[model samples]
Target: MEKIAQPQSSFMKLCRKLSPKRKDSAAESQHIKNGDHDKNRHIEAVFAYMDANKDGRISPDELQKSFMTLGEQLSDEEAEAAVRLSDTDGDGMLDFEEFAQLIKGDDKCSEEEKKMELKEAFKMYIAEGEECITPRSLKMMLKKLGESRTTDDCRVMIRAFDLNDDGVLSFDEFALMMR
Candidate 1:
């Protein structure tokens, strides 16, 4: 039987940079030292893909193009704005270190901190002196969270966790939903 060759996807093309036969010098090893070995390799692959010209820096044009590839269609201003958020050295471009920081996120919040943060967020959906999120407010909050829910969807969601049948979500209920 003959084996058929499959076309390489863009992702596959990016990953090809990590072929086992590829060798890196001491300079490249420095970038790999910050993260788990396997994870660093993947990050490096993605970084290389974003550095479209292989120029070692991701300019706004390159970042914009990468977003366009993902169907996000970032405008020049939007792309520059994104770069500025992480452009630590202010060169108007992102080096691998800066890019990695942007992707890895800030994980400094502890569990208690997260709970307190969630409580604060939950409070935003409730009225003053109220300890629960009303059905209407819940619907509005869900929309703010990028969820497109109908009135029925909100009612069903509340019914699922409205332990007291008060047609609202108490902090305990909200915490359960968050978890």
Candidate 2:
């Protein structure tokens, strides 16, 4: 049997409209490079894991349970509110696309807020008073996160987004890499 194609959600449409166009083939290729591909796959894996009972949709209970598994407590009201925020179909459950939107966060977040959050995350890998992230810092952060990687591997990762040909990642370069 042929599978039916789902309609695009308004959130996705807005994202496409707001996102920048690729400059060239190289830019397009880099956009889908290994790290991004792995991130997307990881998101799918998490969503699948959260959707208990083998259902395509995630109910509020399932979402709450998933949060508990991660050692985070989520109230029923909060879970329901989260589902309502992204439930375009009013089904009271989240399909994969809706879940993705929830994961990305609501549209209410401002650009400045996003930048602040990114800066905080970036700071986690850098030393005090340091403005750039070096390979040593990146490798140390990755190790702390349970993903062991060599300093050379971290250096190559930074080189991919090192726009100024610098050996480290400044905030601007890190922001671009996050995108």
Candidate 3:
């Protein structure tokens, strides 16, 4: 079969940097450290999602590595907390399936995060069709973060991250801002 080429978008450029792989993945395997990463196709994508090392099955250490891979500023306390919350099996370890289920929110999150986005549009609209977080504009950004974060909160975020002083947070900066 002939392979089809996928075009890269400006947004894809950033996601490629963050995710850096094709959406389709291979099968999953049990031998994680041996470099036999993906034995299950969906699990493989999940591994790619959670596996910073591209080494299958996320260990406690791997979870931290995953955050850093995103260039996120995560403190030890916060990272450990999130890992513990998602670790599930209580083995003090998180396998690829475990990692996938958790990020997918395992029935906890109202919706599943099936697709990945590097576009500023998706980031701004993670709140999901809410008017406050309208797509494609700087005007409603803060209100989108929700009722918990007031206008003052938005101002505080802008002040902290609007590095270029452009008044608007670019997709890269916005991703970091949520951190």
Better of 1 and 3 by lDDT: 1
Q: How many residue pairs clash per model?
A: 0, 0, 7
Query: lDDT, candidate 2, residue 59?
Result: 91
Residue-level lDDT of model 1, residues 37-119, one tens digit each, is: 75566668778878999989998899778746543355677667667777899999989998766554423435664566456
RMSD of 2: 9.6
Please tell me which predicted candidate would have the highest lDDT against the true structure. Answer: 2
Lowest lDDT sum, 10 consecutive residues, model 3, at 1-10
Worst 10 residues of 2 by lDDT: 1-10
| Candidate that would win on TM-score | 2
TM-score of each: 0.42, 0.49, 0.36
Writing each residue's lDDT as its tens digit, candidate 3 over 1-179 gives 00100111211322333332323222423345442332244445535655556655566566555545433444566555555665777876667656555544432322112233334334543344433222233334323222245555555555576667755555556545433
Which stretches in model 3 have alpha-carbon errors above 4 Å? 1-43, 46-56, 106-179
